[model samples]
Structures are given as structure tokens and as C-alpha cells.
Target: MRHRGGFRCKPGMKQGSVSLSPIPTRIVSNEEFNPPPQTQAQARVESLITSLADEASRRLGVTRRDFLRTTGGMAAALLAMNAVFGRFFDVLDIEAVEAAAFAERQGDPYFIFDVQTHYVGAHYDPADAETKRKGAVTKQALLGLRRRVREAGLNPKLGGDKGTIDDLSWENFIKEVFLDSETAVGLISTPPGPYPQEAVVPPKEMAHIRDEINRVAGSQRMLAHGLATPQLGRADLDFMEMQAGTLRVDAWKCYTGSPPKGVEHGWWMDDEKLAYPMLEKAKKLGVPRVCVHKGLPLGPVEDYNHPRDLIKAAKDFPDIAFLVYHSGFKGAASVEETFTKTGEIPWTSEFCRMKRAEPGIRNIYMELGSTFGQLVITHPLICAHLLGQIIDAFGADHVLWGTDSIWYGTPQWQIEAFRRFQIPDQLIEKHRYRPLTRELKAQIFGLNAARVFGVDVHAKRNEIPKDYVSRIRMTYLEEGPKPSHRLYGWVVG
Candidate 1:
């Protein structure tokens, strides 16, 4: 499951159990790094959204919750963000009150293929008290901040205040990814576990879920990743063979930053002896898309998580598509101010610069999972610059869409935010960066990924409407959609 700064939802918890802000105004971590405290700008945006919702809901004769669930509510949230954060979002005042205006602005849907999404499998033990406590406040305890919060007991009154495995169950995955969001196809990914074979959601289980979802939908709507740990050497290569032959995995997901149990250091992608063999095996197996976890440092060693190694690895294996998750973003809080001042994002900038020098490293693709979700709300200028820079550096054809969802609850808000997002003219003129036009967005959203993953988007889009998943979603919407606008991750209170 997506790490949420060491917190998990309590058992028996469901979406929409408590009030939620239409747009998240606070920083929420994916447990890769500690999320910074709510900034003054974010706090102001939150306050402004609250007041706007109150006034608008009263005028419309609906509750604040009901208003926040509509497209108009999403418009109001964007408007408040623009008011506080310097007009980065494209939203209008009329769109915030008028339903038709908001609907008109949100044009036809794009082929949304989320490449980085997750959930806990059946192996996740709920009754394990230690796991529960760890899931509740592991990161805080490690950082020595919130030990008493766990001891003080879970506040069941709040939505998802309890720590349990069921919160990230398979059912929730289907509901959130398929029914709640407009995700046409999702790539089921996994985090690095002590043993790749017995992961939280092992490759076998991931494949099983993939098969089940597509089987039920009667269409290809899911893809699975087989975990690869090159530090284990031969065993890992053998495991890759089984996954390729028996499991028939779509890609090989590797976490070069996370060392397996008993290993002193993490492995590198360019390591000829260790990682190259795995890459070679993957190429031989006919699954050449090697999705690696580059940014969002996994452990105490942040050096391992940097995206520098991928340049060489990708250069060596031009046939393999190295999908770099998080786009090697160092983290939101650390880079926002720096980016605003210098127009340079941390690891991502370095990555782009490296690629510019080479100019032939087109095999590497940038995947925006937690990176986009974090920056879009906290600092849209940085978000704009980020999108602009990547498109300029790598071209729109190489930037892929990924929303490390289920941690952020549903992927819909991220999708909506992306649909309306635009790089301002000033930033465009100053940096000579290309505008985020609809055609380019369509490429980044799904077209680029479709090419990488061998998905026939035209065929898939036509098939999705007739699938069982679509039928379920249609019925669910007919019953009055109650999206839990909740962020499952930990936020600074």
C-alpha cells in the first residue's frame, strides 16, 4: 500500500465518514519523506476555501459537504488556490457557482492510464497489533515526534483514524481505482519488501489481482509488476524468469534505493555485475519496461534514491524503457522555495540536465506519481515549471502520468487538477518552455504511456465503456456519488 507517513486507516473505516476539503491544502507524504508542516499559503487557501464553500452552499441551498462534492466545488477550491498562490490555476468565478459553466470547462475525458497505483493484498494481517501500531505512527516514532498520538488511542470520530490492513484491502482498490476515478487502466505496483517473494503484495498476488480485474471487466484494464531485487543476484534472476514465464508480468518493478534484509547497501541500476544481469534477463524475457523507484528516499541513505544512476543504465540498455517513478523529485517542501527562486527542481532538474547533455537518452521516461499530487496543491507555480521543464527537456512524448493513488484516497482530484492545469505565459516566455496544451497533455496523460506499455488506447477506450467495471461505475454514479474527498496520508496538524 502507499505509505502515508506511517499512518493506516482503522478497521471498518469507509470513505465519506467525515468532512473533507475539496482540494487538499496541506502536505501529505507517501511515507518516503517527512511532510512539512502546513505552510501559511496553504493555511490561507484552506481558510479561503472554507469561507467560499460556506457562502456558496448557503446561496445554493445545499450543505457544505454536498457543495464540496460537485464540479463547482472543485472550481471554488482552484479559485481559492489561485487567489492565494498567484493565479496558477485556470478557473473562473462563474464556474464556482454555475454547474453548467464548470461542466463546459471540463471537456471530454482523456485516456487516463495511471501507471503507479497500489493497495495491500490479503496477506496483510489485521490482527497483528505491532503492525497496526507501526502502520499508525511508525514514521513519527522513527523521527521521535508522535509516540503519544498512538498511545493516546485512535480517534475513531475522524475518517480513517484507525490502523488496519482492511483499509487497503482489494475491494477498496477496485472501488477507488475503477469506480471512484476515471482511470482506464492501472499498473499494479509493489514496494520493496525484505523478501521479494513474500512482499506485502507479492508478484503472484499482484498478477492474481490483475487477472481477476481484467477477467471481471472482460477487458484488459490492469497490468502487474514483478518485483526485482538484483542484490540477491541469481535467485532474483530466477524469480524474474518465473514471473515472466508463469506470471506473465507486464514490467519489472525495482527499488534500487531499498536494500533487502541483511544487505548492507542498496544496489545500483548501472552495476554491471548486479543489476545489468537482471536488466538483461528482463530484455530476454520480452518485458523490457523496467520501472525503478528513484526519488523519495527509502531509508536513511538518500544517496541511493537519486536518479543519477539511471542515465548510464538507460544508455546501456537502450532497448529497455526505464520508467523513473516520482521523476526523481527530492520532495515537495525541500524543492518548492528553491524552484521558485532558481527555476530548478532538485533531482528532477539534475535529471533533465543530464538528459539534455546526452540528448539520446529517450529510453528513460518520467513517471509523476506522488510528485504531481504533492506539488499541484502546495505550489502550483513549481508544478507549472515542473511540467514545463520536463516537457521541454524530454519532450511531451516521454513524460508519463502516474498518481500514487489509494494513499490520496481517489485519483479523481489529481486527474481534475491536471486537466485544468496550465503553465502561465510569463513562465513560458521566460524559460522558453512549451505550453501545456491539450494535445501535449493528452500525450502525457496516456498516449505516451500507451506507446511505452504497448496499450492500444483507441481499442481500449472503446472496450472500457462496455466492460463490467464501467457498468458498476455507472450504477454507482446513478445512486448519487458520495466521493470521500479524504486524504489517507498524514498531514501536519
Candidate 2:
């Protein structure tokens, strides 16, 4: 059992034991620690865990919470999920599960390279202290849903009174990404605020954290992303030079929906005048790999953020790699109804179909950020279809594993879930999708990323053993892992 003790808790309340089962084990819904399950499926999953936990706790001689902390607890959850849903995950007997957990307690394999990760400064702004304080107030003013959430009595005190800003700090980010999860390498990306420099995370801070982590580890474990605002024109060009020349960025992270200073609405990637100028600049600067935030659309930016523009941009610039983050998921669509009615997923299917039509757009890659996390937990079949379609269209080589971590707490849960997830044979046969082979899974997991980033994986594997970070990880595991598996994103009631 993984004990929870590293961090302090509220008075009269213990630290809610959270798990992706750091053994990276799968499980039941964490309604107590996470947002309450709103739907019937979620509620059912919760009830199953409660019932199973009751029986298992009685048999194992432990409390329900204590049981939930154990390998057997995680096994019970995964087994319950498998029983309720189809056999999408692999679950073993309690003894076997405990043994497997023991092995993972030692170490996990498949060098995990997370391409999309985020962590903001405690104060996400540096402009004004008063402005930042008021900004927090303005932000809280918009959160009227918390009241509605309270009215519904569905996870009223969602994270148990822990302030939102406090949870998303540098210390927690490192623990959640590195100590708590098996992520060997990560790329730091951010959103555009005033300009790239004064972003939620400035390029300098991003680079500093990247350097500091690697320096402490004594190996290349982190990569920083430079911001690109094509609409800003020359200003953006200047920033790109600074990021590449001065900051020495690994790649460019752009948000098509976020307009630069001069532009009013925001421009698409195919726009020759606005967007292409930045792309041209990036090519000139020699940091050509462009990671664009496509989908998980916000309010005003919906139209511009769609992955449709990627077709032209990718075809136009074969030398430049275009990564479509979030895999163009429009919203949390009803996976069950979509499959039942049309046997199609909305945005992902459309993007994949686009690839089939063009056949020349090989440079555009589909990244699984929030897309994988939401679907795998909510609807595995839809998740299966989404993965199947993307892999079939982009090929296993072009599909990347990105959890959009820190926001989702640890990437460990997503990682564990993916390792256990399987594409059903019926769906595979119906759609002619590739059964996620270990070889293919390895490619998507980190090998493909290693190839993209030009990391010598074989050499790193050798070097990492003696690195400072490896030593840190060794001491950390010996001390035992205590993960605060709290969900840090906006929760829908």
C-alpha cells in the first residue's frame, strides 16, 4: 500500500490519498479526492469501488481508505472498471497484482518523454502586484459554477479547500511530473498573455527551470519551448530570434487562437501574411518544429484553433514539423452516442480523414494532451476509436504521447491508464485499426519523441544511471512515494 504523508493536510482532515497507484496501477473513481462522478457511468464506477472496497477491506483487514491505498485497492478498481465496461484493461488476481506492484515499486520501463507539460510561476503575472491580486478576484468572480456545484452538492469543496493557485506551484509541478510519475523527459510550453516574454510562463523562467532541473540531474531531462505569435509580425520575429539565439529553445509553441498585439481576432496557420511570416522566421532561425495548440477550444478563439488549417500549413512546409496538440478535440462529445449513431468521433476523425484525402500531409502530428486523459477515464471505446483513427491516419510514428500534465495533477494516472488500456477486437475489426502493439506503443510513448528531438535514447539510458536525477529518483523511491492525487483542472458538475 502507498502511504500518504509527505505533505500536510487541513485540520480535522487527512491528506486525501490520491493514486494513479504510483505503482502506476489502475483503479476506481477517486470521488473523495477528485470531483464527484456526475454521470451514471461515473456514479456506477464509484459505487462499485465502494462495494468492492467494503468486501476487500473486510477480507484484507483494513479500512476502506487504507484498502484504496493498496495494490489490491487499485486492482479492485481496475477489475470493477473491467467488469462494468468491457475488458479494455488488464487486471490480475490480488496476489499477482500486489506482486506486479512490487516490481513497479522498483522501477518502470519505456523512457517516458512527455511533449506537453505546464507549470506557472506562483504569481502567473509580473506586471502589477495589485493588478495580479485583482486579477485573482476577477477570475474567482467568473467561477459562479462553484456555487452551482455547491447547489448540486456534487463535490462541493472539490479539492477540500486547497486554494487553486497554491496547488499549481513550482514545487508541486516537479513532484507531480518527476517524483510522482515516471517521466524521463518533458517539454515546457505556455499560453500567450501580453507577449511571449510576459506570458503565463516567460521564456526565461522556462529555460531557467529546464536548465536547473537538468543541472541538478546532471543530464538532459527537460526541454523548453519558445513562444511564437505570428500575428505580431516583426515583433514575433524578434522574439523568435531571442528565444532561439539567446534562450536556446528546443522548439516553438504557438497558439493560433491567441492573437498578438496588432491583430484583433487571431489568425490561422495557413494565412500567408500573418502566420506564414512567423513560420518563415522560425525556418530562418532554424527552430522549425512548431507545436500549435489546436482544439480544447476556448470561447472567442474556437474557429481559429481548429486543426483544419494544419492541412495546408503541413503540406506547405514539409521540412517543418507541425504538431497538433489536443488532437483537435472539439469538446467532450458523447462518445457512446457518437459510436452508436455514426461510428465516428468528431474532431479526431475529421483530422484523420483530412490526412487520407491529402496523403501528402505527413509532417502534421497528432498529440494526445487532455484528449487522452478525458476519454480514457470517461469513455474507453471512444478513446480506442480516437487512437485507432489517429494512428491509422498519421501512422504510429507521427502519433505522440502528451498528457497535458500538472493541470491534470500527475501524468502518472494517464500513463498507468494507457499502459493498461487495450483496443477492443470488435472495434479494431470494424474500423481496421491497428492493435496497439508493444513496439508501436513504445514508439508513441517515447522512442518516436526521442527521434523527433534528436535524443540518443541508447546513450541516455546509460548516462541516466549515473546522473544526479537518477540518484535523486533512487533516494526518493527508497523513501516511498506519497502522491496527492488531486485533480487541478476545471471540473464540470
Candidate 3:
């Protein structure tokens, strides 16, 4: 876990059965950086649920579980939150049931394309994976636990390598994404390592898995990230060529935080020599959308992880789209003063301001991966500010939806939270921020990413309603909707 000798990335190759999924499971962290407060808001949600459950159950004449599944049930939950936490959600009254208000809210029509999704392979070398990697405790432990699940059908040996055995087998991912969450299309992205391909969920394997999953589903609902290591220079460039020419990657996922081996520190996006070449190659390859992993400071090169450098790159390469993952949010921060006094989030607000300063720089976009998940639970006020500020600065169409799931387990929670989340009238009126209206939410949820990634929303919209994903979900719910509400981020005590 320690970065010694100024080496940011420890080099090694990752290999296994090559199951098709998103990113490798080893990349997941279950730590809760922003645990929910136990004061008024907590008491309020509990009281609302308890009191409303009784009242709503009597009125609806249904069990708690059955009620929770209804529009009324969801409305009650939001109303309770509104009672305690102000108007953070927009929900209609229970009386709107006859009007199909609940059905309309539940039957979200947006094509949700998660720009960040990860999964580990069926197996990974133990020495390279668990021993060397950060967050190994959570990563390895979950891998061990998932192997025991009967549905995993995990081969005990997993090709007889000294590795962490996992059911990160491709099928589980499909179940989690297609059946578990409302993610219509997912762009598979991964972290980098000393040996790029050896890194968990490498580019070639991502492309292979993407093809296989789409091929299996008989639908083009998967996308792959071409891993870019600007630190590696020519080798990285060559990998880009291979990924573009053969692998046919949908976009580029760059981790300025995790530089390749032998590099003392990470490089910046505006680093004309190191970073621009990769952008140039992406442009040449015809896939100009480059997703940079910013805000989540990993390893020793924390300097490059802030996303401040992306402004220059955005201005210079107007053709290439620079998607800033995690919205430059540094985990969880107290929003009370930050939002009130400065009317800005540290890195996030700064990043948005940078975008605003250069109105012509339309290529820069903000992504909410771990950022939203942390804030939504910790404080809805923070969530409101996040949604309000980013949309206000980057525009609703520029903010993409990403859960960094399997790490957060089913993205269903985040999806439900965001769908229900609304900016309070106080914040909206005072800050003059755009309302987190349903239509705007639809754009942020998926329409934005759909356009950026070139997904045929019209075509997918028609097919998804009757697609295998929906069919399987229907049968799955009929059997019983069992959601694994697990968070894989490493929580510091």
C-alpha cells in the first residue's frame, strides 16, 4: 500500500480465463469515506419509514415489502426524507397512483450508459494481485466470498495459478448490470499497472469481453476502454494503435494518478509531450473520446489527479472529448460551508469554473462514479450541491452517469437515489442553479453519455423495451428481486 522509491505503479501482467465483463474486480474498494450522520436526518428517515409504513400499509392494504415496491411506497420514502432533509427529492403524492405517476417514474426511458464499470477476471495471480495491489483486503476478501456463492460455479483452482480465485466470471457481471441495475449500455473501463495488459481488466481483454457479451446478448450494448499510459510514451502509443486497429476500443481511459513503472511521478493532461501524444493518437485512430480518471487520488502521484490540467487539453483539442471521471471530487467533504460560503466544491467547482471560463471548450465533461455514491448517503445536501453545481457549469448534457459498480455492488441504489434526488428550492433560488428536473435528470442519467459515446439512443430505446435484459429482469423480479446492497470501497477506520 505504500509508494516507495517514488515509483507510482508497480509493473506486472494480469492474466486468466478472460471472462467478459467491465473492469477487473480487484479494482473495487468498499471503504465508506462518508458514512451517514446519526443525527436529525437519520432519525427522520427512520421515523418516516416506520410511521409512514404503518399509515401507508393501512391505506394501501399491503405488506411492507409489497408497499415498498409500489409508487406510493417510494413516494412515502421521499416524503419522509423531505420531512427531515428539506425538499431534496421531487415526488408526487400517493394520490397520483391512479395517474400512473409511479409507473412513469419507475419506467425510466433514458438509455443509461454507465461510462465506468469494472470486474475482476475469474482468477488473478495472488502475488501480483492481492500482495502488491492497494485495497487488497477488501478486493481479495470479496473475491474469496464471491467464489463461495453457488451461482458463481467457480473453478476452485482457476487454471491452477497462485491467484485469488473469483466468480468474476462474465455471467455474474451480466446478471449484475442487465438484470440488477437499469444500465442499458456500459462502457468497460479499467485501472492501469506496471505492465499495462497485466493490470486487472486490461484493454485487450476488455474489448474481447465487450464483443463476447454483446455477441451473447445479440445486442450491441457494451463498450470498451482503450487503456492509455502517457507515461510510457511510445509503448503506450503502440498499445493505442493495437487497441484502435484490432481491439476497436470505444474510448480511452487514462489514469494520470497511476503512472506506468519506471516513471517517478505521474504526468498531467496538459503535459504537451507525454499526454498530448496519446490524445493525438486517439484523434488519429478516429476514437477521440478520452476518459481521464481524475479526483480519486491513487498511488504517489496525487499532483496529477486533481483534473486542473485538463483545461489546456480541452482548449487545445477541441475535437477530442475529455471526460473527467469522478467530477474531480476528492471523496467526501463537508458541504455546509463549502457550498454556502464559497458556493463551490474544492476540485469539482474549480474544474467547472475552468470549463465556464473557457466557454468555447466544450470537450470537457464531468463524470460521477464514486463521487455521487459517497455524497448521496453522507448528505443529500451535498448531493444537491453536486448535481446543481456541475449541471450549472458543465451543462446537463456534459455530465455523464457512472457508478463504478460491482465496487458499489448493484448501481440500483445510486440510480434510485439520483432519480429521486432534487435540488431544494433554497439552494436553487439562492444559487440560481438549474433545477434538477426530471427531464434534466434524464439527460444526466444517460442521454448525455449516449450522445458523447455515439450510442444510437432511438434504436436502443426501441429494442431495450423488449430486449433480453428487460425480459430477464422481469422473470428475475417475478422470482424475487434480490439486490446485493454491498459497497466494496475500502473504509478507513
Candidate 4:
């Protein structure tokens, strides 16, 4: 089609020519072409739009079908874009001084609570290649070897490899990240691998694992999420109570995977056959909360960790206060629908792949442990918006901060990104992400965790020092160790 103002015409077009603007023709005399001052504003806008478009295009490669299917109308797409872009500009324009001011308002001391963290034990390191070979070949003999590999950190390539265990040592892990960063408290969970199908270890070994966890946690503001398996005999339960009641371990961590016969393993949280009894026992034990793993199945376990099962359990045991890990990722549609229909339950944005099925849903709280960095950089706006939505849905007090660290490598980057996220003052005032008041930050940072863990956060508030915010920011942004993953080549440096 031909356009007005001497624009070229295309063949076989019947419509009148559309008016077109002319391109500038002045030749640049300088080494680089500099836009006019007036155009600088336009250029900035254009640059931001272009960057946003490029990101959308990249994500579209993976989610085009979903986008097209969900956004049946162009208007809906535009609305989504407007919401996303508006937030992007807001974040980009955040002044460092404002962030510092926000940090200082809390007396520069915020109670730190890492709701999700992992610990590697001595068994994580294999003594030699013989042990490694034995672990690779024999089932029973491999239990200790696998634990060693987990402690060493699994090579993600090996389907189970995480990273080097040396990188995960409690001494190094805490010192390099938490200790120096002003971490006041942490919730530590057992690494997933130590539980074997063959149940090679006696009940004593399971108790020993709890002891090791406590030892590593030390007296420095720390709480434990005791790992449990039905495979443990009565003696094991006795030992666990001793650890929990005496040591004051906060919660019980349960895996929803099916175990092989004779091997002691945690019961699947969703398995009605096992869940009711387990819940009863947990309730009887006076355990206030249970952290259930409800996401991707690890290793040979299949169909055991579905969110639907967790939902049923939640409905059945309303008093249990179940913390569904991954927040029923596969059932996000149902979650969204549930939130839309009934304004209860909290959700997290890290599970946006599933949550996007419905926008503005609430009632599920999100933990930002494993889903930081990669998602934050790639889908900054959407992730922030989702976080906002979660805040709105659950209230900032309900949202918890976690770093599936150790497995992902220290919580530094995750913490940094959250601290750096530039949520606008207007949005904050309007409760856009459910109003992140100072009280809410305290709740998310420590109060909620303490309540869930049945600990007294107020008493330990003094344990959190001033300058912690600046310390976290500096540690994460300036002094943090770089991620070894090659995928994030640009941002690491």
C-alpha cells in the first residue's frame, strides 16, 4: 500500500495511501550520531520499549501459544503490557538514596529470617573414588556415597548434581554469605538425598542427622525444620521429639515421594492414605506447622508431589497450617480460580508459570528461594508484578523470603534482587503489592517466620543489627561471589 508524503507503494493494494513521517537525513559530523536533546526523551522511551519488546519476544518463544491462548483479545494483551511496563519504569527510576532511606527507617536493623536454607553433612563428602564407585554400583553401599555427593553438591548435569559440597560447607556457606551479611536467623532443612530406598541406616543415623543439623545451626539465631520419614521406628520418633522438644526445632519437613519397601523415608504429604495419620501424629506432637515439598519430583519418585493432593490435605486439615512448597505448581489454575472466587490463601510469583492462568489471585504465600536471579532478570516486570499480586493476595506479612540456597549457592543474589526491586511509593501506598509497610517487612523478614516456627521474633529483634540492609546490599551487589552457572554470563560480573 502506498503512504502519503512520497512513501513507496506496494503492488495489488486498493486502499488509499497512509500518511507517513519522513526519516531525518542530516549526516552526522561527529564520531557518533547524537540525538537532539528533545529526542533524548523520545529515545529513552523508545529504548525502554524496545528492551521490553525484546524481552517479550524472547519469552514469547517459549510461551507464545499460552499467550495467544490466554490473551484471546488484543486489548487484554495491551492491558497486561501496560501493567508490566508501568512497573518496569517504576523500578528503573528508583533512586538509590530512596532505597537507603527506606533501609534506615527501620533503625537500619531488620530482623533477618531465611525461611528456606539447606545444610550439607559430613556424609556429603565421599572419602575416595572407591566410595564413589561403590555408590554408583551397589544400592545399600551407595546410600552414604549419595549423601556425600549431595553434601559435595551434585553436578546438575548428572541429573542429580547440584554443585561442589565444599562450596556448601556450613562454615564457608554461613561465613561467606549469612554470617557476614547480618543474617539474624535461618530455617535449615535437610538435603533431599540422604534418605535412601533401601533404608540402610538404623534409626540412630536419622537421629544423628538431626543432631548434625543442630550442631551446624549452632546458637547463633537459627531454627531447624526436622526432616521426617515413616521408615523411622518408634525409637526414631522418640529421638525426633528429643531433638524437637529439647532442641526446640521449629517445624517438620516432609517429602511427598513414595519410598521403596523396607527403606525408611518421609511420607508423601498428599497421600490421603498416609497424610491423615501423619497429620494426626504431627498435631499430637504439638508441631504447629509442616513444610511439605510439592514441586518437581526428584529422582525415581513420580506423581507423588502433585499440588492437587496438597490442596486436599489443606482443606481436610485446616488447623495444620500446611506450607505447600512450590504452592501446588501444577494446580495453579485451580489456585487462581480459588483465589478469584474466595479471597483467601497466599501465593508466590516464583510459580508464575502456573499462576498466570489467572491474574490477581491470592491466598497462597510464595517463598523466593530457588526462583530468584534467572527469573528476576529474564522476567523482571512479570515477576515483580506477580510478587505484588502475592503481596496483595496474602498481605506482605504473609509472604516469606527464602533462598533454595546451598543448592543454588548462597542467598546473596536472591536477597540483593529483592532489596533492589524498586517498588513505587504510589504502589506501596495503594497496597499494590498489598502495601509493604514497615510492619509487613518485619513480618516477611522475621515475624511471620517466628510465628510459623513458634519462636519469639520480638525477643531476638535486637539480635538483628543496624546497617544490615546496607550490608546485605553491599554483600550481594558488590562483594558476593559470582554464580558458576554459565547461563548467567552477563550479569555475574
Best by lDDT: 1
lDDT of 2 by residue, 1-493 (tens): 2111111122333212333322222222111112223466755666777778788778877787766655566667766667767788766655323646635532448788999988744353344465356435433532343333334544333434333433323555666788778888999876556567777678998887787666545578899998887767687789889989988999998877766545557578998887888888889998889998877554244677788998998888888999888898754545467768887776678888889998767788889887887777667778888999999998999988898777677887677677777899998888899998778888888988888889899998898776655654565567665565554433432
TM-score of each model, paired residue for residue = 0.87, 0.80, 0.77, 0.53
Candidate 1: which stretches are off by over 4 Å? 1-19, 120-169, 340-342
Expressed as tens digits, the lDDT of each residue in 321-406 for candidate 4 is 66655443322213334455653222333333343453334334555544333334333443554567656544565567775544
In candidate 1, which residue pairs get closer than 3 Å at backbone N, Cα or C atoms, i.e. clash? 9-162, 10-162
Of the pair 2 and 3, which is ahead by TM-score? 2
In candidate 2, stretches whose alpha carbon ends up further than 4 angstroms from where it belongs are: 1-37, 95-97, 101-108, 120-169, 261-263, 333-339
**Which window of ten consecutive residues has the lowest lDDT sum in model 4?**
23-32
Best by the TM-score measure: 1
Residue 447 CA error for candidate 3 (Å)? 1.7
Q: Rate the local accuracy (lDDT) of all candidates.
A: 0.79, 0.69, 0.68, 0.43
Task: Candidate 3: list runs displaced more than 4 Å.
Answer: 1-80, 92-101, 104-108, 120-168, 333-342
What is candidate 3's lDDT per residue for 1-493, written digit by digit as tens? 4232222322231122121111111223422122322345555576666677667667767675556544465566666667776777666675323327666666645568898887644232344453234334434543443334213433332233332333224555666677778889998876666667866677878998798666544467789998888787798899889989999999998878776776667778998987888889999999999898888666565667898899998889999999998899865545555667776666787877777888877888899998886666556787788788888888888999999876666676578768878777888899898987778888888889989888888898787665444655676667765443333333322
TM-score of 3: 0.77
Q: State which candidate, 2 or 3, has the greater lDDT.
A: 2
Give every collision pair in model 2. 217-469
- How close to the true structure is residue 98 of candidate 3, measured as C-alpha lDDT? 33
Shift in Å, residue 34, candidate 2: 16
